[model samples]
Target: MGNIVKERKSRPVNLDIKTIRFPITAIASIMHRVAGVITFVSIAILLWLLSLSLSSPSGFETASAIVDSFFVKFVLWGILTALAYHIVGGIRHLMQDIGYFEELETGAKSAQVAFALTGVLSVLAGILVW
Candidate 1:
């Protein structure tokens, strides 16, 4: 009985992979989800601006002034960055749909390339828009 219980209590063995290596498509998929969230938040900002502009002439002026401020410009930069990344990443996905990056090694390299491109482009968009 003691031996039987000890054997039963032993945990199942699991593969130990300290570093999880995910493919390019997987990372792109995750980034798409995150960018979607950012876009959704941007929609909220648009609504707030619309409301401010709709209240009255002074309201519109106030909204205009607000938009011209450093804080508003920074927020706009974030929105642009999100949009840029989402657009580039989406194009990469489209490429994959067309039979590109089908190989495991090529897919991983392409994903790294896509990530780098998104970063560079998003930064450029931010600088220009801000």
Candidate 2:
């Protein structure tokens, strides 16, 4: 009976995941992992672009033309945004390592600050690039 009750308490979450509101630190941690993955995948695309640009003249022109297209530009901008957020969040985690935001409330507030700063920088980068 005790095991059954514990298992019931730990049941799978309902499909209403969107309605859940996570804390600031939780949001920051989640975004940090997501951005890391995005950056990893983005590196592949970037390498391909770099190789094409370094190849024959036709290949270089093709790479340049792809950059000029709105879709490619948008994808590049997205990668940049992810990179920026991941870097900033990583720094925040480093500070925590040195005992800066060890407190629960302070850590949560710092996370919110990081999240807000990421949004501002991402927007500025998008505007500057596209």
Candidate 3:
């Protein structure tokens, strides 16, 4: 055990991200986590909008005006894009949990499909937002 520990401690470690190459599945998984975070943060903005719209009539008008701005529309588009990606990634995870796409090749293919679907959804979201 002592010798094993010493050998393990002596092994080389690569910590530079620039030198690292991530597989498609790994990238997909990382993006899924990022999208989840974006979605979580966007919830606060959405709730604020909901609250404003549900307030007095003037508040509703204010919310409507805010939503009509180019910046707000772009933000909405980003939120929708993140949500779409998160949902796609979530379905992939569910399929994996059910024993599908366990192999490396199949997992990569599933990630690719998720990415493609998210791309299409993002385009649609952009169109809808604009």
Candidate 4:
């Protein structure tokens, strides 16, 4: 009995990623990652569309019809929005790496600027898409 080590029972750790309060900079970083994945997946769809359009006249018509569909247009708009935000976020990250927005205040300001720019551009893209 003495040789048997008793395991201590402790309260379970309350670490929940979703329950954590994230700062604007952290949120921006997370959005950047999400946008990157969206853009990457969109590339495959775009390539498939390109191939279809280039295959033959019937293929081109089908591709055109697909593009004209409301669902496809919405998806395309979302992809473009993701691209715009990703580009803005990437530029902010690059600036941070160059020591421009390393400070907390400047970093927050840069993130806000990126978000504002992306929002404006995304609106423009939506207008064009519609």
Candidate 5:
């Protein structure tokens, strides 16, 4: 155990992120985590908007006006995109847990499919937001 610890300590660590090339599955997994965080943070913004819209008649109009802005629309699109990606990634993970796409080739293909689905969803979300 001591020798193993010494050996591990002697190994060089690559801290340069740009130089690292992650596999497709790893990239998909990382993006899924990022999307989850975005979705979680977006809940606050969405709740605030909902509260504003429900507060009173004037508040509804104010919320509508705020949502009509280009920047707010863009932010909404981003939130939707993240939500879509997170859902797709979650499905992929569930499939994996069920003993599907456990092989290297199949896993990569699933990751690719997830990326494509996310792209399509993002485009649809952009259209909806705009």
Candidate 6:
């Protein structure tokens, strides 16, 4: 006699990423990725600013005017904030790779500390920019 095999039914798919609760480490990792992308894009803006400032006297004046704008200052502040976060996150990653904060509890705590440091430095960056 041949035995029958049973097939299990698949569950419905949930496509919303927002419905999931991510851990602090996961959030920090995602933020680190986003900050890296922001920093990469900011490089083009920086280069343009540099070129405008260094090309000629008129160019320098134009660059100065652009830099003096409130919107430009805000954008620069955001870029700097992203840079600060990316740097802090990178340091934490490096330490982890070197065997520090390897445990789950310690890793989570480090993530929290990195975020706090980022917040403080972001405020400082905003202050300096304004």
lDDT of candidates 1 onward, in order: 0.82, 0.92, 0.98, 0.94, 0.97, 0.96
Candidate with more favorable, higher TM-score: 1 or 5: 5
Candidate 6 per-residue C-alpha lDDT over 41-86 given as tens digits, one digit per residue, 9 for 90 to 100: 9999999999999999999999999999999999999999999999
User: What TM-score does prediction 3 earn?
Assistant: 0.87
After superposition, candidate 6 runs with Cα above 4 Å error? 1-6, 9-18
Residue 62 lDDT in candidate 3: 100
RMSD in angstroms, candidate 1?
A: 4.8
- Residues 65-104, candidate 3: write the lDDT tens digits: 9999999999999999999999999999999999999999
Residue pairs with colliding backbones in model 1 are none
Model 6 accuracy (lDDT, Cα):
0.96
TM-score of each candidate?
Answer: 0.69, 0.83, 0.87, 0.84, 0.87, 0.88
Q: List residue ranges in candidate 1 displaced over 4 A.
A: 1-25, 54-56
Candidate 5 residue pairs that clash: none
- Of candidates 6 and 1, the better by TM-score: 6
Superposition error at 27 for model 3 (Å): 1.0
Question: Tens digits of per-residue lDDT for model 5 on 40-109?
Answer: 9999999999999999999999999999999999999999999999999999999999999999999999
Comparison by TM-score, 1 against 3, better one: 3
